[model samples]
Target: MTTTPKHDERIATMTFASVYPHYVTKVEKKGRTKAELHQVIRWLTGFDDVRLQELIIENVTFKTFFEQATINPNAHLIKGVICGYRIEDIETPLTKEVRYLDKLVDELAKGRKMEKILRSTS
Candidate 1:
């Protein structure tokens, strides 16, 4: 008998609060700005704390990495490191789809196919 693997759909709907316990609570605390919250997420996800701290000090927020992963319905973060990256580095398919949509928008804009301009450049 052959069996196919069952797909899980609940994986993508997870928020930071669900994946990382108390993550939201941590962000709500004082002294942790939005930028710092992103840094903490990065650190938890696999980016080196030292490296993240350096980048955070420079005002660089890498939240997109995490935001990208929560959109997938079958994606989940493992409890180990892979190729020097944490499992949290894995992105959700939903976010990937959103990125594709964004790319499409850019392509459409370059082609001047959009009727109304959503952006203004002077």
Candidate 2:
């Protein structure tokens, strides 16, 4: 497997709350705003600002976080590598979803435009 079972398991159990601060820090350090970060996340997960804050407070694991999400239809448009794994090539569904989120945040931190990152057809 390109990713170890152990590694996958760890990500599944990891709390979305735990990694949220890091995501914020990464984007902020790049001069991006948390609202933009939240926008990216909302585009992917369909969680509005209010629900997202609730999820953070609930400390849900990635598995639960995704289970409750209404993933955007355009999510298939999120294609690229993140953390050394190609998003399109990842076989596991959950892992692919996680990578999709990671890839978006990376794009934001790299200064990709919101429309492009959101896969808008304009």
Candidate 3:
């Protein structure tokens, strides 16, 4: 999809690797584990630890990183406001996915249960 005149092109260009460290810091400062952060990321993107490290080392753009993902089918269940926008209402697919990741990380930092953050497929 063309992230042209309408969508925020900045997020599209920002490397996932650059944002990754901040995510780690956010969770760690809140007394959460890095492993838990990784788990949430894996749930959203379907990237294992090995593949995730490769993407981080490659410094792939958010667009490229998500393009390569097998996003969870239940990701649609992710709801509520994130960064001022309702997750389910976001029109841009890439932006929505990024927000979903953000919401999940926030949940982890807030001590939300893993089962709840991952959501239910049933």
Candidate 4:
């Protein structure tokens, strides 16, 4: 079996709350609202506002956060490059999911409309 990369391991162990602020900052700098960020996160993770707040307050790791998530079926539709890595080319399941979130946020920051960022429903 292949060992997980050190980068993936480090990211999995990092607190979701720690990374969340960076996500917010990125989008806000590009004129996206916190509500839009929340919506994108909810769409991907299946966590409502209350549950998201609970996770943030608990300081869970990215691994724990995704483990608890009821990820959307539409998540597979998120395909693109983020930070020089292609989201679709990521072989690790957990890492791909994490990058999907990152790609969505990047799209929002780049001013893609909400409907397109969310992907096709049908």
Candidate 5:
């Protein structure tokens, strides 16, 4: 019964561009390439490189980002703990989507195989 923290409100309003660098930094610190990070983001959000760049240039908030996203049907396959919260256990739809991205980035940082992280478990 964990309540949504006040900080989550700020997170929802934060721009994707503002957070993009941190994601790049996290993955790059573990020897992952920015292209790989892009691939994961595209896989989750259905944003191609050009569209992704547009969102960054426009400084879209996470709430707006997900609002416009064509989230992959397989996204629910992403299951894990991130920042002490289980992705599947998150109650708010928007928060769960945000955490889904976080979990994917965490996997990328941890060096999980791209196919596994993308849940291409076929």
Candidate 6:
């Protein structure tokens, strides 16, 4: 059976290497857990665990925008220190907060590197 993480054991990404093993990238914060890293892996590669293994056999260069965002354990059921990354959860107007996140995801999907994306924000 697929036993889930304990309420306190939600995962997160602390380093880019945890997800992007091939990129030799680094995040300013600490690295995330195996499971936390997996979400980004799946999101970046566009492949589930099963499909990922299959693709690995073909030797492909898959990339994902490795980032760490806070997870609200009580709300989305994904809680962690990473929650600090969500501006909406921390401040007012969650709707606006999500719009920004959506835009970020879109930019990331379009091959925009995280460093470049962050530079624009600052």
The TM-score leader among the candidates is 2
Candidate 5's residue-wise lDDT over 69-121, tens digit each? 99999999998788788877888788889889999999999999999999996
Query: Local error of candidate 5 at 120, Å?
Result: 0.8
Please report, in order, the local distance difference test score of every candidate based on alpha carbons.
0.34, 0.93, 0.90, 0.90, 0.91, 0.34
**lDDT per residue (tens digit) for residues 1-122 in model 1:** 11112211232333323333243344445333444444433423444556445543544322343443333222232123422323343354443332332332333324432222122222
**Candidate of highest lDDT:** 2
List clash counts for every candidate, in order: 5, 0, 0, 0, 0, 11
Model 1 has an lDDT value of 0.34
- Estimated TM-score per prediction? 0.22, 0.95, 0.92, 0.93, 0.93, 0.27
On residues 1-103, what C-alpha lDDT tens digit does candidate 6 reach at each position? Answer: 2212331122221222233442212221233233433444454324466654544454432112212223222233221223234433433223222324333
Candidate 2 deviant stretches above 4 angstroms: none
Cα shift from native, residue 8, model 1 (Å): 24
Output the worst ten-in-a-row residue range by lDDT, candidate 3: 1-10
> Over the full model, what C-alpha lDDT does candidate 2 score relative to the true structure?
0.93
Off by over 4 Å in 1: 1-44, 63-122
- Residue 96, candidate 2: alpha-carbon lDDT: 88
Candidate 3 lDDT score at position 60: 99
CA lDDT of 70 in candidate 3? 93
Residue by residue across 1-122, what tens digits does model 4's lDDT show?
A: 22259868987888999999999999999999999999999999999989999999999999999999989998999987786778778888888888899999999999999999889564
Better model by TM-score, 1 or 6? Answer: 6
TM-score computed on alpha carbons, candidate 1: 0.22
**Per-residue lDDT for 102 in model 2?**
98
